[model samples]
Target: MNKFGVSAQTLIAAAFGAAIMGSAFAVPKLLAPEAGAQPIAIQAPPGAPLSFADLIEKVEPAVVSVNVVSTQDLSELGDMDQFFEQFRGMPGLEDFFEQRREQQEQETPRTREARSLGSGFFISQDGLVVTNNHVVERATQIQIVMSDGREIDAELVGADPLTDLAVVRVKEPGPYPYVKFGSSKDIRKGDWVVALGNPFGLGGSASAGILSADGRELGAGSPYTDFLQIDAPINRGNSGGPTFDLKGNVIGVNSQILSPTGGSVGIGFAIPAELAKEVTDTLIQNGRVSRGWLGVQIGDLTPEFAEALGIEDVKGALIADVTTGSPAERAGLKRNDIILSVNGQKVTDSTSTTRLVAKLIANTKNKFDILRDGKPQSISVTVGERPADPNAISPVPGGANPAEPGAPSAVPGKMLPDFGVRLSPMDDATRIALGLRTGDTGLAITEVTKGGVFGEAGFEPGIIILDVNSRPVASVDAFERAIAEAKAANRSKVLLGLRVGQVTSYRTIDIPK
Candidate 1:
């Protein structure tokens, strides 16, 4: 087979727009199937047509192309030096810097209006619309262009960034045609699904493919993602659109695709209907979502871990720890207890458990089934409302130092290699450059072992270790003491507060073997 194709891997940006420029090549139309190649023939239970003409005709009316105009800084005269720094010894260094110097003659900050494209559909007869949060997030002005060429202004109902779901309302009062969600649980593997979206700003485009695997976790950016994998031809502008079942019910909302050349290679992902419905319903009601929290850290019960715990079957989520004063602690849920179900629903794994608990109302009592010491037990937990931003520390008026009352002592000058990380004391100049204020004492990561646990867990040089297990560690001795305590207690993971520049976050590292 003579194959000619480009490598494609593109994760759609959080904010999509036409301002992101690229060259487009017109694809040549094929006369027929080439040299022994055949067209794909698919059907629904052996009775549907190969083409989805009738289905598309019915659903296309509700589809729309969402355009958003936002104003932001495009470039700045001060950035010229940094931009030219990359081409330090390139062939056109002189020409590039000369042109940039000419442009710097004006010496002005560059700001411009940017346009982005994505697809969406009407979900209610009263003008309620559904789309991706990334599509309309931070949008200054939003315009919805219908399939029949009617442009309508829309207002943001609300958006949940954690779930990547959003809702908007149109100003024009009407009984607009909308799509309904079908049971995603009923959709099976290999079932025919249709995707409708404005791919690359082409309004009301549709592609068909079989359902791939479901319940995929994209890991970092999407910690709570349980995506429905599809083989549809979803592109950049397809975000916030709908994927439909044979009976014309929306099964999923297209959000991401797995590609290398910015084009679909038949591996696309969608937010499952159940999750989307849950998020949208909350957004419509409260104009916000409050996820229920149990305040317990958990991990999957793998077979090896289960056997180590002397359990017979590899099931349930292993409770790692319970937060103080949290709902889980108040409900008497102890560490090492395996959560088997939520409200009688089976907890397949830790991720599903998190998703299930998030759907429950705050301050509501939910039944949790657990395994404790080889016996099954049930407990009723009154879940608490999860905080909107966990990383956000409420600022005190006239910034008070939360550090200890005593004047800071000098830091030790020794380095460590026990945790696969070498620490160095941050000097006054380094501390000032890293944006650390008074009373801030963070140990700089002078070195990271690439093959060790620190690097494997994404730790790199230039990150400052601020604390260990919520204990502020200003010296190497403090850090070593924390690690020694955890190791003595036979703990596998030790949590650390890390400061990368001005932002601080938590990361867990596995104890080196």
Candidate 2:
């Protein structure tokens, strides 16, 4: 008001008038009581409970806090002499540096006891407790703290890292309060769930929220688990806890959460009870779970891949490379074959196929329906036990040595300006570098024009084009013939099988009209 050159008294009077008017209209509407209006009260929807206290009391006894003590190496801390070198020549600093050097020289390999906490629940009357594999991994000693403050020693019965589940047995046996796994399939999206655990080392904590979603895949770490997403506030110590349904049945096991602040953001994941129960049962019986192995590198059949392959539906797993001597190779499965179904179960994608195959019994004959060379065929093969370390099985034998000695340095090639790529005939040096076996024919990429179609498709020099539309291509003329045939058939896309590094994969490229 002062800067606008208006009188202070007048401005104050005007502001007072506006405030009076605003309050005159807003006060009655917001705060004034109406004669017949009952006091406003929020009510829960019909059938919803006002509180979860009853459910909490019934299931809290089964919940326990898992205390783990493990060893942590501190040997790296003994190398600090280099940091004090500049101060060595300073006045009156010689004694300090000498003492520090002596301490470092006297120090041996050091270690410390690291303590961590998680949660778990009893699953049987004979003291069979189920928790997460991570909770007890590398643990030198494990202690279970009960809800009533009773401490008991426990021994690891079995642990499955793939599913992040483990079973432990109490040293002193008794009829413990245990919970049973319920059917996660019956839980709807909006169904209520109660998570009981020890969050932040606070024992006997409980949280309730609706099931946010189901069948959420959280990347490669949990490839076999289709996690159930929940809005419950689960923190660090909540891992291995139980997520219970309204009927006090354990439906899921809290495993991970998505948060940037290291706290709950209402996005948490749980392993469904069905898978948990199955894995726990297997661990109890065999101390480990054995999965079926098919020995094939598979990928999802995307729309572009489907169109290039002349398939109508993109709902199967595409075989990229079949490992030599694997069950798949023994069964006559090959690269570029699309797996349609496994033992009458429709293959949806690579993940679904992986889960289905893992559920199969090892050494049992299983039927596989596949589309090979645009024709449907059936094959039977006995599933083999999956290797404990998945990386033990190489997709293909031999290593690439692109710069082999005594090889030709230059070779004649073809340049496709329209596609923005130069193709060269595969030489012995390139074959050895690509780890290709004998009789493998292909054209190698020599150069790619930046911002061109091939370059935009991620084609790089040294990549070997193995096949075009499932037809092996050895020369530029063969490639041209395959493209001409595709154009003649009115195909808009062509599938190219490529060998990059030591592995092989398929990519589809668009054809210009």
Candidate 3:
């Protein structure tokens, strides 16, 4: 009585059994028997069967309802209470304040009650659990409720927003059931899957679905999401729950969905279990994930740009800017270089490139294959640990200075046309006058037109350009060389490395060839 018709072997066995029993008790006790006139018992084949009940029972203990509560400060609550008290004289205001005061008093001890529900799966017996970062973000109190009516307080261990994964530790250590991560890469597109979570606070709920897609790009909003799409019924509260395969292995963590009504329309997204495993391991060890800094801004290679670069196919990402003194620069990456692969793995686009680099363990060495001037070249690069908030302003090599109003042109002999603005060589007197530091160098703007490209690019006449197309431009000839190379390669745009005040940064703009 399985879903399908009885197997041939089973039918043959039944025939044999019927032949041996004849007509006497063939129909009476064929499946089961006793002594004297006892019939033989039917035996099933030798392999283990796929049972959903067994898998669910085994993994249910690992899945938990994660509740987060945040509180407001006492002073803020008191201020609000007083403000409402002052409005008591107004009509209905007194009643409102009375009710508000009662509610405030009830919530006073806690100060605030910001409740959010998600799901998590235990990973270690000593109380380590994994869930989505959004689940417990900014939560002052986190509680994990087990299936057996047991609630344990959880503490934040670490989280990676890029991967949307987090690790938490329970207050009391105990032997806890845990689930293992499986190879999401081995899962086929139409594979059966299950999602376990507290959807809408409905605890320990399980929904069945099929794997709809993999390696899906959610968007650039999250630069690291290589989502696995499924038809599982996941919702807001399901954000951090485990998505399991038939074998009871965790394959993903439900993260997002594409729904117009905030309900499951058979479209849900999850962070793949592989990525989650890597992130959790790093966070557990270092308290934070350390990403590799490629020091390059990249964009998708266009068909025109691909043809210009003599590429048979437009499959690689185009390099827009290679930061000076960065790993990319030290590895000899340049603007207009097309990155095809990292460490021999193909990249689909710039986002994939970034994610792959970000996933690399910090301070690791890898090989990069890039296309330069239509020729493939491989370079060895040792990635550096990404600095926290790399955009923080620091002392630049030179100073930043804008010329005084009606000031005369300082370097008249060296000038270049930039978006109808004239840029001239930087001088020590101009730097001193504009409060520009000595470390700042390169061409400074001498003049600009109103509503010109220079203004659109946020450039004033006095700002200096340090590098063009990832090449240092100490003189006007170097600047021309960079521009000439870009034009010769038919690149649509080029990046300029500039120094302004204590800030050193880059900007990419179209090159009018």
Question: Which candidate leads in TM-score?
Answer: 2
Looking at candidate 2, what is the lDDT of residue 24? 53
Best by lDDT: 2
- On residues 146-247, what C-alpha lDDT tens digit does candidate 3 reach at each position? 988799998999998877889999998799988899989988898888899999998999888889999898776667778899997898799889999888
* Candidate 3 deviant stretches above 4 angstroms: 1-54, 71-113, 313-315, 330-332, 343-348, 375-380, 390-513
Q: Give the TM-score of candidate 3.
A: 0.62
Give the range where candidate 3 is weakest over 10 consecutive residues by summed lDDT: 393-402
Candidate 2 residue lDDT tens string, 1-513: 443345778767766776778865432212445777665667786546789999999999999999999888776433556666678788778778778777766788678999999999999988988999999998889999999999999999999999999998889978899999998898899889999999999989999998999999998888799999999899999999999998999999999999999999999999999999999999999999999999988889888888876778558898887776789988989888889999999988999999999988999999999888889999998999988876566443452233432222257588888788888778766666655666778888888998677899988887889999888898989998999988888888899999877678888888865
What ranking emerges by TM-score with the best candidate at the front?
Answer: 2, 1, 3
Q: Which ten residues in a row have the lowest lDDT in candidate 1?
A: 6-15
- Give lDDT: candidate 2, residue 2: 49
lDDT of each: 0.78, 0.86, 0.77
| Evaluation by TM-score, superior candidate among 1 and 2 | 2
Model 1 C-alpha lDDT versus the unseen true structure: 0.78
Number of backbone-clashing residue pairs for each candidate, in the order shown: 7, 3, 11
Distance from true location, Cα of 210 in model 1, Å: 1.6
TM for candidate 2 is 0.84
